[model samples]
Target: MDRRRLTARALAELADVTVVSLSQIKTGKQVPQETTVQRIAGALDYPVAFFHGADVDTLPAAAVSFRSLSSVTQRERKAAIAAGGIAYLVADWLHSKYTLPSPKLIDAGAERDPATAARALRQAWGLGEKPISNLIKLLEAKGIRVFSLAENTKNVDAFSCWRNDEPYIFLNTFKTTERSRFDAAHELGHLILHKHGGSNQGPQAESEANSFASSFLMPRADVLSEMPRVQSLQQILRGKKRWGVSAAALTYRLHKIGLITDWQYRNFNIQLRTDYGSSEPDSMQRETSTLWKMVLDDLWDQKLTRADIATGLNIPHGELENLLFGLTAASDRPPLRNDRPALSVV
Candidate 1:
């Protein structure tokens, strides 16, 4: 509640009490009746005695520590951290119920270091030097729900949230195709690499995710061969179809791999910005979630959907609707009945 910025006066109104009474309670000047306390607790969605406690349970102790220096600005960094923290809390709390399917996430356990993470993921998908043909289909196959966010943001792009142990990534469909692909891959990096290990948001973490996406989407072994001939914008534009990565991502990849000179990278970026790329990803204009396609066949195989999900958990349809959509709330969970397939929650 405190981290969420619920003030005393606001709490009073939520509790249906006078500001004076609220202040009295805050200052320890008066003891509120049991009924009043209950109302306050209900309105605040917290335990009845929470207001008087020094340490609130809503915010975790680990989250209370001071933050590190950010890769972006302090202000934007703070917002990003809050966004991650909120999502993590929501994801954790919501996962307690219902068996969640283990996503086709490749665990880089033996190769836990960064160098191995990329290849581990690539090999896990049977992607031997294969260029990613489509971001939408690839992610959908891995149990990632793709949605287009209406709001446009700067210094920040796409993001994924795990609610009810289900991973959903939202792309800012407003961005150009080139940028959109980068954002999608970046979000996938979040899911694969950072979703678990207490990773925080900021320019630095964002950079880490971005780099992973670039490497994951276009492996150096496969794409570096053409770096010498990638001088003209036409070369990159043509390469975009096969890679499903933006010109920017490819250009950055070239720079990272030392294929293109720093000056060349900067110049090409200028050209890309001037052209502004082309249309958004096919579904971006419509702004819909496409995750249902790839995993549906699997879910059907396992007999899981709204009906099966509700039946397994003993929750109602109306409640299931809320769980499926955002109308109501439910917990996130790891696969409950392991009698079937694979998945994980972090």
Candidate 2:
């Protein structure tokens, strides 16, 4: 159900079984026969061995900090959470083989405002109010396991949560590069501000996260020094590349920091809506996971195909590729020589 995003009724239909029988099997009230099990596996496109693996723990809906919870459907939400579960398994496997960075995030639950919390984190990390060159790489450097949400729906933009001692972030790659970067920072806000204990969902939390992402991505001091006063939408469109954010995001940040007047803000927003509605013009290049790339390269050296990894984890090769920002699909290229030293995760 989790892997294929199928409901009981849907699975029953696919497997040619009655809903009552499927429900009974799911509840452990009745055991499925071998033929039924095979039919179910075939219907879901999962190997039968996948069912025999140890129970995989899924992220509870409550613990996840979804960016647009109000807009996401229940099935989309469930599928996203299930993706997190697969990510956890893959992360564990990577940890066993390599030493990833330790978590450097601070708990800012007590912070009065998201901007202050963002500043504290930046100072702690020695970022010094500069634009983040690569938000995905920075997150991985700080020991955040970043994964791509491969669901075809746009409703689930991004989500983040702490799994035991490790932090994980899932991003929807379907979005424009700039919006995706902001989503990454927004999830970082949830990880930092709501880590200890707080409502990481709902409008208030979403607003705080947006503020944190604004501050974290385009620091107030940096923006002031770079562009003290915004004049036109074209100027904003040009300057937005400096912070790797969309024109809309940069416009909001400028208004929030008083660099732009309310009148200007409203005008720019109207112009932006007119020009590019729900889309970014001249979008930045989408960010991919550096850590996963290095991992795959190392595995390629050992002649370990993505299929092998997926088989070991009891998941489909496509699912593994989906989680990895489609990095594994590149494995179809000519194999590399196994002459390099073992990869040391930095």
Candidate 3:
């Protein structure tokens, strides 16, 4: 029901069963017959074997750091959580085949401020105030599994959560590249600053994540050295490209760091609102997953296609594609030799 976003009545109707029967089965009050299980699986487009598999771990709604929690509907939230469950299966499959990087994130929940936390993470990672060339690659190298969210809606920008000592981030590729980068950084903040608990903190968590993203993407020293005085919107537009952030974000960062006065900040914000209400101008190219590209390429060498992966996971091919959409370097690129050990499973 969660995977298909179906209610009991809807699922029962599709499966040619009564709602009471479905509810009883769901509540463990009655056992479902083999024919009933087959009908339910058929209705949900999942294999019968999928229903018999061991129980899968599911992400709790309170644990997921949703960018816009208030705007997300219950159905949408369920679907997103279901997607995370599927992502766990995919990650497990990858782990069984190849060795992956270990989690390198630090717990920053005790930090006094988001900026300080961001800087600490940067120093720990040995980034040294340099503009990250590819934020997605950086996250993956740090053992953060990055997946694309197929929601394709503005309500769900991105989300992140930790499962079994590993971090996972899901990005909504429907937004501009600049926004997506910020979203990635924002989720990173949640992972470190609120690792134990913060998703339920509401506005406070979101605000800290935003500040962390701004500081992480555009370091205080780097922004000061690059653009000390922002006189006009054009300066912001030109400077934003270096940090891969939106003009509004750059303006806010400048104001926060005292590089720009409150009056100037207000004026610039008004101008930005007039020009680009909810969209970014001159956005950069979206970042793809280098780790996923390498994984797919390695699998390709063993004559395993994406369809094979979906079948192995007992999921639809489209579901796997949705999680990986726009994440690979190319769809038809030839396989390359991988340095990792050979797959343990065919």
Highest TM-score: give the candidate number: 2
Which digits, one per residue and each the tens of the lDDT, describe model 1 over residues 72-182?
344443443343433343233334532333578764432255435777788888888787666666776676655443333454455665544566665554566656776
Query: Candidates' lDDT values, in order?
Result: 0.55, 0.88, 0.86
Name the weakest run of 10 consecutive residues (lDDT summed) in model 2: 332-341
Against the true structure, candidate 3 reaches a TM-score of 0.92
Tens digits of per-residue lDDT for model 2, 121-194: 99999999888989999999998999998888889999998888789999998888898999999999999888
**Once superposed on the true structure, which residue ranges of model 3 sit more than 4 Å away at CA?**
197-200, 327-333, 336-346
For TM-score, candidate 1 versus 3, the one ahead is 3
Runs in model 1 lying further than 4 Å from the true structure: 1-101, 109-115, 161-166, 226-228, 274-288, 292-346
TM-score of each predicted structure versus truth? 0.54, 0.95, 0.92
Model 1 C-alpha lDDT versus the unseen true structure: 0.55
Candidates ranked by TM-score, best first? 2, 3, 1
Q: Of models 1 and 3, which has the larger lDDT?
A: 3
